[model samples]
Target: MTPADLTCTVLGAVRRAVEEGALGGAVAVPDRVKVERPRPGGSGDYATNAALRLAREARLPAREVAEVLSAELTRHPGIAGVEITGPGFLNITLAHGSRDALVRDTLTNILTSGSGYGQGRALSGQAVELRHRAEVRAAVTADAVRRLLEAQGALVRIDAYEDEAAGPVPAPTPAPGPAPTATLAYEPSPVPAGATAHELHRRFGTDATRWALLRAAAHDRPRLDDGLLVQKESNPFFLVRYAHARSRALVRAATRLGFTAGYEEDAAALGDHPALLAALGDHPAVLASAARLRAPDRVARHLETTAEAFLGFQHTVLPVGDEKPSAAHRSRLALAEAAGTVLAGGLSLLGISAPEYL
Candidate 1:
């Protein structure tokens, strides 16, 4: 299962424990639970610290909570095993069928949703007002954040403010929905001198300019060097776009070889691409978390990680030389297509382009 799916499953286990009095009624369930890759020397496909987080409310030791939740989780059809590690971490492994199902679901969602694949309703019914300083970097950062918030179903309005004296203007209640969460005046670190909006557009063009500004956290100074414009491996911006292009290229080559993208039911037939699969599965969670945190850099970093994983796995997507096409090739091609869709969708959120030709 995807990371998001596993998170929900874990959360559900918590809820069930609470209801059944295993965790006690006083133990409150969090709105979301974080499940991530296991740490080095850790076991299982993914790990979580939910038990540790809920230990106090449950009035039990962290390991006890973990054991209780483990009982509930092991009953899940998708979960093959759940192990409690040091200090009550839940390390989970999915059933083989669940892993294959994740591949099918991830590809289907990306293909069906197209550019809207990672968009979620986590912020649905919330209204947000963002006012940024009259600086290029601030404006760009605010724009990217606006896109992320809107993608998560927030009704967002943004404008520039030249004077800090113009404090947060009281927002009018949005029509028939939840009230505004808060009015935020976002004043991110300014771009260095000579990186004016117009100059950046002229120097790096829209794609590179946005990438340079959005790749870093809002509070940090951006690197507006010529390196961002370089089309080499050293440039992360180049690597991201190039990976998308490579994914598309693989598709074209597969088409010429008289085969198209397809998902495989058997995990063994899909070969060992755990890292790539995990990256793809984590896209939705990354987008949701990025939106919640108002950090587009999280999305940017996720795209970079996904791109890196996809690039490393690209060579296997198509047959080499006269090697005949098979189900494995088709499955690999589908995975590549999903990665391309995610790269394209994320770049669009950052106000950048994922050109088919890098």
Candidate 2:
């Protein structure tokens, strides 16, 4: 099951607990239950503080509420065990056999949904007017805002001062001079002096330039330097794109090896790598939050997290020399591909290109 599914399972358990008088009928089910990866030294695929949240309403100790809900949750399929710890947290471990299936299904969903996977109608039926001055930074910011707003089903109209119609005025004419010979010359657009956007674009091209522009808080001045062009770990843009390209390369290599991603019993190895799973599962929430907050940097940062997780999981995805392809390898590969989809989709929202080859 995906993390979202597990959340619903926990929510249901709480509701059932309430109805069955386990926690008494006075406690109300929360509108939403937060399920997240456990902290370091915690033993679980995911954890929830539902018991803590409902403790006051139930007029019971947090641990008591956790125990009641834990009992109900442990009975559910796909959940191997549930632990109530430290004042009332539910640490849940998925059944070993279910982890592989969950990874397989997650990847399948990502592939089928393509770039539209994390899209939502949170701003549906809303009309938004984004107004900005004619400055380069403002214009670029507005464009990014337009894409993000539109992604959430908002009807966005960008009104820039530069695009407005000019009032009637006398036109200036150049002094008469000798006619010059006809010649074609390509002159690039002019950019403001000391403006990083244009300079970065000229040096690093479109994707990197846009990323540098939108990856910072809108109120903060973007750092536009050769630093962004660096092809190292310090450069998040490179890391995100490189991660995506690496995933694509793995798929190609797997195809040549006469195997494709599939579910396997031994694929439970994916569960052992919680970082990657957590990042993939959190993708939808990141996208929605970015759109709601009108901040593309959230998506950019999320891509970095996803990239790091994938890099850590990379060695496990493919076999070493002479080692034959196995079901576990295929499942791990599927997880890798899902990470790529998330990276690409998030980059698209940020108006950055996720190249198949970096």
Candidate 3:
């Protein structure tokens, strides 16, 4: 299920629980439920602090509150095991096949619609204005987010990025022979070999503005972003990067697989250098938190789906194959490293760990 689906289901339960008067009105606040990954093998795929949150209001011990909610939540088909832990947390595990299917569904959605997928109607009447980087990196995935949202019918407005195009530089002549194609299986028309007209226009430059126009039209408001997107709510990419960076295997494997996933230059190459300190200078924590949430899908119902993506890259579903580690590959890998660095940096802003070797 998408994040919205989970929230809706949880809210429904909370609303009903409140109506049932089992624990009074205040204890049923679904928004209070905080979800995240349980330590490996910790009892569930997704864990929530819902019980603990309602403990005081319900005038019961945290564990007792947890037990009550666990029983109530299980009535929903999607929820499998609901274990009580620590003081009074609810560690929820979705049914077995659910995760696998969720992943397949996400991949199918992403592949079929690409940037256009996941655009929703719930947000049809709403609007979000975004402040994105100018001449954005072709490798950057946030560009896809606007499309995903629009695909779902939500109105999205993107602020104009700087006009100057930071067209990717021609990598020094790449190795002659075609590098590996054994590992090719992802999205957004991978960057093609250089010397082109499309290269002249920044993808961010075009798409961001295009998205803004669509957002204004969809939401029926021009200044919606100024009012809606809000102050520093943050790019959802932060969440994606967080998960990948935190997953030791995901990070290391992504490094090897050339998933150079960063917002700037490759992570390894940019380390502790005197130059970059200025580039990253003073980015805020709120922006960092959103980035650190492990791609926002983390251990939630969406994790099974997210994990599969990493697996695909790790296993060479799109193999680097035998392309002699060409300049293209190096540049691409550096891009991936940039992603890792950005993800880790995002988490650090949120007070989370973005391990280096992992």
Query: Can you give the TM-score per candidate against the true fold?
Result: 0.88, 0.80, 0.39
Which TM-score value belongs to model 2? 0.80
lDDT of 1 by residue, 132-173 (tens): 776777777777877888788787777666532112333332
Per-residue lDDT over 226-323 for candidate 2, one digit per residue giving the tens place of the 0 to 100 score: 88889987788889999999998998888998888765645456767877877887777777788777777777888899999998888788789999
Ranking by TM-score: 1, 2, 3
Q: How many pairs collide in each candidate, listed in order?
A: 0, 0, 31
Candidate 3 residue-wise lDDT, 1-358, digit = tens: 4434555665666666667877766664755445655655456656667667777887878787677677788888877778877887678776645544443343334334422222234334434443444432222223333333333333444443444223232222222333323321122222221322244233223322222222221214222123222222132222343345544444355567655332222333323231222111212211222222212212121322332333333332123556444443343333333334434433322223444432
Question: What is the alpha-carbon RMSD of candidate 3 to the true structure?
Answer: 17.7
Best by lDDT: 1
By lDDT, highest first, what's the ranking? 1, 2, 3
Native-vs-model 1 lDDT?
0.82
State the C-alpha lDDT per candidate: 0.82, 0.75, 0.40
Off by over 4 Å in 3: 1-3, 25-36, 39-42, 118-358
lDDT of 2 at 331: 80
